[model samples]
Target: MKYDWVLFDADETLFHFDSFGGMKLMFERFGVNFTRDDYDAYQLVNKPLWVDYQDGKITADELKIIRFEGWATKLGITPFELNSAFLEAMADICTLLPGAKELLDALSGNAKLGIITNGFTELQAIRLERTGLSDYFEHVVISEEVGVAKPDLGIFDHAHQLMGLPCKTKILMVGDNPHSDVLGGINFGIETCWLNTQGVQTPAGIHPHYEVNSLEQLRMTLFA
Candidate 1:
């Protein structure tokens, strides 16, 4: 029952980022005026930049500017305008996942909590602050800040080092991704709990110490 630290994944775990809304707002804010088709194209082009950014192949700023530029060029808009609009829209639309506050409240004083996310520092910080979830974490490690992403042992090590917990066995990683969150924790020899909100079967060759259907399930599992 004794746990020294718990690390969480940010995007789907802590917050549900409305990427579609944010992108639509970005077009409106930038005055580019794109159609649904255009937005679809933009999403296709922009998603891979995040993977590259997480892999340390691109800088955070590069990923942002490139995503904006790619979408703008495809939509026949100026990249600079798109960039400004996207930043503004993204800042406004970022929000927390359902039951995030309640779960945080339940875990707050009971154990040390932190976040390990694969995202740009600016985007992650804006989301965390806007959602008021930043206060719950003792430490926050982002791939953009650390030059490494999840599923990479280095990021896990960085988080563990920052936590300064005496025992790795007492640390728990909770995340939605099988390859990233669960595999990453296993790689580092830390206990892992998969947040399988979608109820999907565990993928081949990966296993978590626990599986949770929802944040509420997590609360009950931890405190009940």
Candidate 2:
């Protein structure tokens, strides 16, 4: 392996983060039928909160509560209660992406592994444990715990602290989001790989050291 430490982003990078499925399951418990239209409406609130979170404009707690506020009011529940239910539902449905286990197995002995995610603390631990991937990582830095989100150097710095301050050049970040994963890694002076599964155009002025369409491709590239 080219890097001594490999950091991964949790959602969509390693795990299948099916927000719609999670929400549907969560709402089902409350006797609400979550439809595609409901999901679209949820995303309208949720997506911008994620961007705001990555940009450090809002906190994870704020984002979590605010995104569910409308639903909470309608359901006669607290936002925190609704948010917790959603996370639990997400963890229940969590599954690794295709070839995620193979890729991790290939890289395990060669590099120190870590997860630096903007995902909530409520889901990360349980998801990893339930998916049987908990032991693969040396660190799991959550923005919620750090009070700082990705695309911000503080979270990366916190991760480095947990890593005992490894060499910057020997660290590589792999994630699905170009902005939070690639751009943040670039800004932090580390190598990065963007998992461009959708084959979307690379955003302006952001670049990754490598790009792959799937974890299988990444495994091939790394172990070739």
Candidate 3:
């Protein structure tokens, strides 16, 4: 089957979230004088806040503040200071995943590309623009801006509408997460491609139409 519009997930799909370079900058900026264990623990604590934020159970500002607050509290640091540092570090850190540019370039003219991410509009925009990938996409629908997150069929419907596609079947939703990306696409009747970078098994019940370990495989899978 041929797809006209290709929707993508931002963070782990196009870029690595655990960018060590970015983390180093963040550590220095925040003056976080903790051991590696602290950093690891902080990430463990902070990840669920993002899930909550995406699920619409928490506000954006609350998410921003709380993640740092939780981390700071655990490490006996001031939340305000950590929050300030985090914001600055986030703005300065821009790292693209492998094959990101190549994949975007390959698909640019061949299909209508769009970004459907469950992230803040400003941050996602900054990363995309910094990576010089903003031009490849026709539309970027971020959850915070849209007032809805993925796994919710509404956002999928909105993206489909924005693409001006006749139906969901004509579009391909590609991303790293099974719950958010794959299940969300399936919920909307769009063909789903699991960007299983880690080579994990397809979870118990969910099924993706296509499964690939890298974006580089996309061209061959879809066109060849």
TM-score per model over all chains: 0.87, 0.98, 0.87
lDDT of each: 0.80, 0.94, 0.79
List, residue by residue over 57-142, the lDDT tens digit for candidate 3: 88666776776776677657786666656545665766777877887777777888899988666577677777888788999998
Best by TM-score: 2
Provide the lDDT at 97 for model 1: 68
- What lDDT score is found at residue 128 in candidate 2? 92
Per-residue lDDT tens digits for candidate 2, residues 1-224, read 78899999999999999989999999999999999999999899899989998888998889979999999999999999999999999999999999999999999999999999999898998999999999999999999999998889999999998999989999999999999999999999999999999999999999899999999999899878
Q: How many backbone clashes does candidate 3 have?
A: 0
TM-score, cand. 3: 0.87
Stretches > 4 Å off in candidate 2: none
Structural RMSD, model 3: 2.7
Q: Candidate 2, overall lDDT?
A: 0.94
Ranking the candidates on TM-score from highest down gives: 2, 1, 3
- Location of the lowest summed lDDT over 10 successive residues in candidate 3: 17-26
Kindly give the number of clashing pairs for every candidate.
1, 0, 0
Cα lDDT of model 1 by residue, 1-224, tens digit: 45777889987898776777777887676566667887777778777876676566777667667777766677787765666566567779777667778888988888889999885565777777778776889999988778788888989989888987459888999999998899989999999999998999999999899999898888888876
Q: Tell me the spans in candidate 3 whose CA falls farther than 4 Å from its real position.
A: 19-21, 70-84
Q: What is the lDDT of residue 18 in candidate 1?
A: 70
